[model samples]
Target: MPAPKISVIVPAFNHEAYVVDALNSVLGQSLGDLELIVIDDASRDGTWDAIQSIRDPRLRALRHEHNRGAHATLNEGLGLASGDFLAILNSDDAFHPERLARMVAALDSDARLAFSGVDFIDSDSQPAPGHERALDYASACARCAGQPPASWLLTSNLAITTSNFVFPRSLFQRIGGFSELRYTHDWEWALRASTDTPPLWLPEPLVRYRVHPSNTLAEDDVWRHIHENAYIQTLALGGSLDGLDAEGACTALLHNTSLPPLATLCFGIAARRLADDTALRALTRPGPDGWFLRQLAQATGLNDGVFRSARQLADQQSALGAQQCLIDERWATIQQMSGIIAERDAALQAQAELIEERAQAMAHMSAEIAHRDEAITAQGRLLEERFAAMEEMGREIHARDQIVSEQSAVIARLMATPWNRLRRFVTKLRH
Candidate 1:
């Protein structure tokens, strides 16, 4: 059988709810000459059943005898891809209808271009405002124009998601397909593919990444492992982590909910170790040292709230090594103070309890005290009722405040319309 122009490999596992969207996304692309290969990795759920329901001749669904991981499934799909070009689409991720059309054109125009990619949709499947720059070619080209070739996209949105990229089959083969490594495998693949050849960059969030409840990174344990694995891969690649600060930021974001204080500290140390590797000295020169410091601070639990604590400790310790040395000191102080405070406070609380008991004993003999106690109890009940009412009132007030704020913003916007139009006209006249 003749190979198609492009082969899109999709690895699906228990993504029944989203598989159809993924399949329809590929099948509905503007580009033709596309072959869709879906490898169902022994999904016990309705994932394979969903694939069976799709009747497109171009799509070939392969099933495994038993469940394998995403890496194994992806490699299996790779073996089945016969097109001159290769692309990967996760089961939960979809592409904009024109994604393939644009990337394929870029690859065809430049024989040396090993790959091309677009931006990914945020977790909500909506284009993220912060990363929207990757969705426009003009902006991407402009960003890359004056930068050194090696420094091209070193820090920012240079790499594209696996679902968003398309690469030549030869290049994919030469790189030996996807590595077994998890988390940063896509990033590693992107780096390797762009090693000798410059990959075309398409700025656009054509790939819609689904952030569902069952995401691997959602669990604390999984996220930590993924971040550590990514850092390990960065070290293994001989890639200078002068970008460690940026990576640390991404790490913090990825595992913010899951990572404990200690885990974050460890991740920061691991990141610093990566940055300090001798092999990466060339990549991280003098200019990025400040970034390293900032990253080190973040990793050491020095958030804005904790910065003062860090600063206070720095007065006693060296400002440079203060963060690391302060951890033990801080822990010791916290423990010692907590124990001492607990013991003293417990004794004082007991004394206060005895005094209260004596007061109650004396109060029991006085009829006036008994009447006052009843009045106080009634007041307490009234306070409890008032508190509940106030809570409800607070919620209503908050809702009303939000509505008022939104209305005010709308009014402010409308009020500026004439001024904005006048300014625009004046600007045009001046030009």
Candidate 2:
């Protein structure tokens, strides 16, 4: 008998509900030159009995004395694997029928390519809201250009699950086995491997990563998520202060641990110094139900930032109003000049009529003079009333001008305060 070309390793620990589905997915793979190794990490459940139910001769099963975590169990499975290639699949997740076949074909096609796999289901295992089902390779290239192929091996949709995708045994040994990371060791492994040789990516979404309550990435594991994500950012950025620019890196670091209320409070403010809005949003959105980001909002006067942007937008609008006012003032001045010219023309016409009447009505001079005097008196009273109304209107305009000037000054003062200083003050107060 010859050794199998590929060994699919599954580290099982009380995954009775989903482990069988995961195993069956492998057994059904189009590539049959494979061995399935299920190492039960001292599960208290009927995991052992469950393994006994499977009668495949190629299936090799083992048991641990106590519950070793996935990292340890995976390393043990690697030692037991007899094939040239290693595939790691979690007990709760599974592969599509063509996953093993496609991955093997890809690795066989390129010598430099150590591993190859497809996009798996996302964290929800459903299409993201507003996104269509069946995202092709072209769409993926557009989403994350220049990112590693294995990054898309999201644990839900597809993973280099110890079972589905195969990797060269030599490369696995060179990079060292999976670290004893609490939650994010797989991401760390992918990042480390890509530094030397990038994994070959197949654009198909061939892995069905299951989303269930029993999974390790459940929302309740906030501390674990924070710790793992923080460590991962450190590794990804090569320990540079500039490395914090890696999206969601700083906020994950700041909020992951069970810091004192004040310490966590202060760090939340510090997270906002990240000039990237996308990173900021990621930082605020917490693990699982996004509780951490909410906590971040409450801790750091994040509403203040929101208010500031709103106020600035308002000031810009006010400035636009002022510009319009200036245009209106110019228009009013033109109207006043036109009104003066019309009033002068009317007065001249009235004077000409008075002179013609005086010459024509000399015989009835007394009666004509009396009528002309009455007309002049009425015109004088009308002019006096118009002058008084114009004076009152000027006073009202002056009061409104003062109010606008004061409001504009206040806005300018608020805009002058440095945002950085304000954030630092908030952090200090929280600390």
Candidate 3:
């Protein structure tokens, strides 16, 4: 087939969960004349297998035998492009179905533009939190009519990713591929490209930029992030600000004010003394100027840099105060919770003491009852002995009555007989 309209290069690392979706987003675009070149950067996960599962004729899957960084992988993918316009998508990020169509139309509107970009969505394809800052910058760019796109880019990396790129392949070959910076290579390239051909910003969220724990900028080393960013920004300042009149230079310089003191000084130094790259590089290194630079960098952030614009500095201070207030409120809430827990524990302790006292009382009552039961048993035995003695007395009285009756009958018999009366009289005398 002939060369495609666009060549989208996807550099996959460990995005097995997301690579297929990223590829599908490209292949299933409404603008269907594009070729999808996916390079798996020797991902340890199932990213390579996921790429292989895609069977579209427009998709070509490539793999790296060994691991390489994102910069090298992107450069290699760009080298194999066979289309008029070149684009890049990170393996973990996806595009809207209509993104390419809209971006292509934007690129066609201005021949002088290097590339076109849109706002981004978060991982779940929702509006990314704090994305308003990026939108505000875009809105500011729009409001600042006739401002050099290069100068505005110098302010911040509003495009934010190579995934946002949809530029001419020729420009990629001319300006360069990507830099070797670990963190901000996409930004470095954007700065490099904007200086020559300017970038076009589309205000719609056409791409899903995954903000996650494993993001590429997820570096715990504070120094490296600051150091690498300062390095690129300083170098960017050197030649990128040339040919600007007083207004343009001032615009660019003002843009650099929001940067740290090290980067701010670099912009000033590079503007005046950019002949030797070594001198600009030496400003950030540890040497005669190191202590002062460290102090300023460590001092109050941009607050120490009186060179910064007053409005932006005040804004930073205001933001810092707000953050401190929030921290105080959160601390107060935690203390309140702790107090409640302590009170609950005290109440529980009191209940336990009461239960122990009740148990002791019950034990004492049980002992008294046992003693009373023993005395009652002894009294019952005495009553039983008395009843037995009364029964024996009753038997003795009955026997005496029987004997008296028998004696009376014998006397009656004797009286009835001729000698009975004489016998009775004899018995009475004997008694």
Candidate 4:
């Protein structure tokens, strides 16, 4: 039998609900010269049975006794693939009828191009919003003007999903194979595989990336993904990830909640380092960061509230730090004022002691003055008593002198008369 033009690898796990749809989408492709290889990685569900039910000459269903993982299963499929071109379609996703034809035509036109473009769809098989435009070949060529293909891919993955990738088998062999990682294996593989060969961009939505409840990318897993991406970036920077098989590296970077700025910077740098000119030009084009964030939010099917919560958390941290600084400053000021008050108290205590000593000296002087004033008052009272006794003696003397004068005058008058002289002699005998 002639070898098929393309070999489609479908890695099936616990996708019993969607595996049939995935297989039907590939079988219904307009391009019939293709081989389908579905690998069941020890699914606990009926996925193996569903894959077994399909009986087509091109269909090759393989199973693992013990679950290895998606990456291992993909490696197995790659080892068995015998087509000119290789493609991957996740069990949970489906492809459009013209996907293979369109991608094959694009690759055939340019032997240098490694892969083609991708499209997205919801779990209900409905067309994803904002991605309705078909791939514009001319515009894409013009945009990547003057830039190498490998450099363009390093900047941004034009092949948005692994399901959208349809590259030459030769390119896959040259770049080695997919790296074994739990999360971001596709991204890592793309980075390594497209380092030299640039991929083609098919703007049309060729693959329906179902956004369902069972999607592997959960909110809690974002940190792990970011860390894994950082590690991948490190490997790329050190040139160690070129063809290295990074098995279980995914387990090391887990349990993180948010993407740190450093990690984000590293991721950007890694992308630029790996980007071709086309990717760099597309990235340099004028656009808002919000638009990119919104695209991510839409692709992840997460609500805007999650981002708001992160913003609020960051604002709260900033406010808390500012408040802590103010508190520290106020505490220092209080300490300074307490020291000043202590010094003032010490000076006031010294002044109070001096004033007390002066008061004691003044009290001693007042006591001495009071004792001298008491002695002077006693002397003044004694002099007043003596002066009163002298006044009484003087009064008695004057009365006696006046009596003598009267007696003398009477005697003179008696001498003039004998009768007066006899009366005077009788008064003297009576005295």
> Considering TM-score, where higher is better, how would the candidates rank from best to worst?
3, 4, 1, 2
lDDT of each: 0.64, 0.62, 0.73, 0.66
Model 1, residue 123: displacement in angstroms?
8.1
Q: Write the per-residue lDDT of candidate 1 for residues 146-211, one digit (tens) a residue.
A: 544333433233444466667778776776666554454565566566666555765555677665
Candidate 2 shows a clash count of: 14
Q: What does the lDDT come to for candidate 2?
A: 0.62
lDDT of 4: 0.66
Per-model C-alpha RMSD: 38.3, 36.9, 9.2, 19.7
The per-residue C-alpha lDDT of model 1 at residue 301 equals: 67
lDDT of 2 at 44: 86
Model 1 TM-score relative to the real fold: 0.51
TM-score per model over all chains: 0.51, 0.50, 0.61, 0.53
Tell me the tens digit of each residue's lDDT in model 2 across 1-431: 78788888999988776678778888888888999999999988887888778889889889989888888898889888888777888887777887877777778744323433344444445543232322432343444344433333221122333343467777677777777666666766765555555456565666665545565755475444543453444344342232134354443233222122332333345454656423533442346765553455567767422222222445567988999999899999989989998999999999999988986787588777889999999999999999999999999899999999998898777756798568768999999
lDDT of 1: 0.64
Give the TM-score comparing model 2 with the true structure, all chains together.
Answer: 0.50
Residue 418 in model 3: shift from native, Å?
65
Off by over 4 Å in 1: 109-149, 152-160, 222-431
Clashes (N, CA, C under 3 Å) per candidate: 5, 14, 2, 13
Worst 10 residues of 1 by lDDT: 252-261
